[model samples]
Target: MFELILGLPLLGGMVVMGSGWGISAVMFALHAVTLLMSLQHRQSFYGSAAGIVTCLLFSVPVWGMFGHWITAALLLVSMVDRYGAGMPGSFRRS
Candidate 1:
């Protein structure tokens, strides 16, 4: 699930750079579709799915907002998915 969220953009960027304009457009379209699916999946995880839906809807308006730091943001999100321990455990010793 996390991979789909993160990989689409990364792959889209690669395809965009490696090929012609048509390829890029297709990749971008696929990315949007996949994002919609992920948002729906996130919604299923929680009774409230607005958070993911809201995020997916905001991508267009937020374009270029991250500029060069987009990669960093993606990396961070991916890291949290892979390494983050959902919530802090009270059983841990200080």
Candidate 2:
């Protein structure tokens, strides 16, 4: 759920990059919030971390689009990997 929310802006910002920097600013804030939430929940944060990087470099034309695509893919993978804490049978900290 959260991953999907985060991903939308990445893809959307690609199309709106010429409009202004507002989209990038919004994405940065969203990623920051996601990072904080992941820390509080002790969940995997690689996707959010990548998103922050993407936001930072998303003004570089070709490379920026690539970053958005890659980050969005990572977020999708993270969404499908909800049980990424550990192996299925292994004990996990609560």
Candidate closest to the true structure, highest lDDT: 2
State each model's C-alpha RMSD to the native: 8.7, 5.2
- lDDT (tens digit, per residue) of candidate 2 on 8-90: 55655554555476767777899899889988988778889988998886666556667777777777677557644466875
TM-scores vs. true structure, each candidate? 0.34, 0.69
lDDT per model, in order?
0.40, 0.69
How displaced is residue 35 in candidate 1, in Å? 1.0
Model 1: runs farther than 4 Å from truth? 1-18, 43-72, 82-94
Looking at model 1, residue 84 earns an lDDT score of 65
lDDT of 2 at 17: 57
The TM-score between candidate 1 and the true structure equals 0.34
Over 4 Å off, model 2: 1-14, 83-94
